[model samples]
Target: MEEANETIVAEFMLLGFSGVHDKLQMFLFFVLLLTYLVTLTGNLLIVFIVWVDHRLHTPMYFFISNLSFLEIWFTLVTNPKMLLNFLSDSKTISFLACMAQSYFYFTLGAAEFILLMVMSFDRYVAIYHSLQYAAIMKQRLCIQLGFVSWVGGFLIISSWMVLVYKLRFRGPNVINHFFCDSTPLFQLSCNDTQLIKRVDSILLSSIVLTSLCLTMISYASIFYSILRIPSATGRQKGFSTCASPLTVVVMAYGSCFVLYGRPTGYLSLEINKGVTLLNTVVYPFLNSFIYSLRNKSVKLALRVAFSHNKTKLFPKLCCAP
Candidate 1:
């Protein structure tokens, strides 16, 4: 009977902020829709700017482009479905769909984690070894680092996905979050999940701790190098360059630590939902803004692109007989 019940559960209902009032839900729908559009536009613009501007063709821009690309898919995996659920009465996701969402969510998320660390290292190299920065961070090396971030992140989370796929959901099919996160899924599993929980703790701790430590070390070295410079201009320039990546790291790592740093049982669902919303929806928007505002190269690229487009359009309009 237990086995039959497990097999019978084929779909999971996502209870995404269902406790909110109707008016609040409607307001949230438009708000999230606007956020989605802005996130897409901002990240896509960064990608375009990095690709077309030869002057901005450095290792830093290359990594920024890759990070922008990752942010696009990262928000896509869950935000659209969440928007749909805001309007629909039935917020059910299939077993397969949930699994796919979870996989992509973790994949892009983990990739961003490593990518940010890589960006930190790039800064360290640029500041600490300015003379050899070009030689050290050649095109080949940049591409390889980006590739490793994506592939390594995927590999790290693949085991968790496998374990999740094997778990059986028998009775309660409701997930009390926006998307198919492992925490809620674990709660609904009929099988013993002690091993899965332990593995999750180990993996999350190892990855987050290692990445955080490396990022810290890179920044510490970077600051030490900056302080030793005699010129205030050089010190200011160093701080300015590191600002964007540092902001992103703080937001990304802070949210992650709050969400996954502790045992799942200790977290409140409401707090988790809010934190997840900030992490998934708000952070992408913030990331793009931070980079664009702080990085002069990206700002120049944007200005050049816009001016070139306007010039081309103006000539065509004015030439119309």
Candidate 2:
């Protein structure tokens, strides 16, 4: 085989939402800015609540805290750059910077996939073997599982990024998407990317599809276990506990599989952009609300934290001194 020439391009112009009218771009700027802020605050609040509230120190909340932390960095990796691009006339990102963004973006995403699976297992153990749940999901085990998810995700993506870095980009440095994703970046490569494309498809499909399958299986077992419970209230409580995470799992995996599960040739930039928005932008913001608002423990924790802060801030007023 002939050698492919290396990329001469030093920078890439991220043509983010250039198709949108200026007014709409400005509208999107604020909307995305607000969304980012909310995503940060919400996910951070979950982390804080989990940290301070002893009631939430179970294996389930432990996994949630990890997910919330992942969302913080996950949203941070892309949104700030996308937000800046929306405001600026020059949407140029250095090739190295673009690659870095892509690396972290996929890394965090993979971590989330594994973390969600860990959470499903936590739920399964909690329901399936209630007596042994505590024994099985001890603090050391939970920490190890969480650590493996983060490390495994990074390792998986690191190998893929090495391939991405090797691909040559001769010219036309405009990426027609908000971020440097594998699909868009692969489209820009000048070399024979057939091998990389196949590798990417297989890796993404294996990680996402496998995790999704495991999650579904865990939920199935949990559901069966719930059915065996004679009390309606017990069943309702069981469903309530599982509902929020299940919703998140569905949303996260659904968007991801649609975007990354298939070959690059099959993807449309317009549709991909919309799906990216849902997966990256919308889901992070929604995750906190889904996990927190629906959770009684989280609600109570928030109220207690708020009251504690209020008392600290205005002790005399609160105490009627």
Candidate 3:
């Protein structure tokens, strides 16, 4: 009788976007699937080019490869559960599992954010001080920048992760959004989340404001130099190099601000999630397309590889022709 009264269980249902229209599910599934395939292909191609080609062994490409890997991991961190929720009527995740999910999501997201800023700085150095770009952005320095980004993200996000674990949840376990976003998670917790809210505000503000300022400063100088160039061709070349990185920065920072920096409210939850998904999908696709496809060296490498494969498959035809 005593055992019957006590609840014995772990894990809670995630009421994803299931309550919405039925057609929405099908639409979301197709959209997410398409995005996933493109993200995977684009990021993997970048990693392969960076690893196999000796000429791409530079600080810029090194950071680009790292960004590619991070984008794939970023998509995985959120998309699988989202895809699962879209298919399943009742989605569930354990308390510990949810906390772990939140941790990894924020950590990886923050790391990539910092890495983008570092890449901007790299471009600034290369453009303005081309003579000293090698000495300044050496392999050792690139490695250090990557390490710092990861560690900084971990240290900053760990506090909130701990806060999340400490909070109590007594009522509905259903998270409003698809994945365990920090804002939605805060809403679900029963305890007073004032401190967590303050901390989160500070952290998100620091990420957006500081990074935006730095990127803006770099671009301000970059654009100034481009304007001073007497030759139209020189100016166009400078602008073109800045275009890809600037596009990435705008997309990343804009989405980040929409998702995290804004005030948390019941109405905006779904919209926020959608914005995040857009950023994750768009950044990887655009980066790979813009930076790799347009690059002469990468195109040459791909062409060479394709020819080699073709030759191997038709060795007899080569002699006949």
TM-score of 2: 0.96
Better of 1 and 3 by TM-score: 1
**Best-to-worst ranking by lDDT:** 2, 1, 3
Off by over 4 Å in 1: 1-7, 316-321
Q: Assess each prediction's global lDDT (C-alpha) against the native.
A: 0.91, 0.91, 0.80
- Could you estimate the TM-score for every candidate? 0.96, 0.96, 0.91
Better of 2 and 3 by TM-score: 2
Q: Output the TM-score of candidate 3.
A: 0.91
Worst 10 residues of 3 by lDDT: 1-10
lDDT: which is higher, 1 or 3? Answer: 1
- Deviation in angstroms for 267 in model 3? 5.0
**Model 2 misplaced stretches (Cα beyond 4 Å):** 1-7
Clashes of each: 0, 0, 0
Give the per-residue Cα lDDT of candidate 2 at 285: 94
RMSD per model, one decimal? 1.9, 2.4, 2.7
- Write candidate 1's Cα lDDT for 223-288 as tens digits: 999999999998998998898899999999999988998866778999999999999999998888
Candidate 1 structure lDDT: 0.91
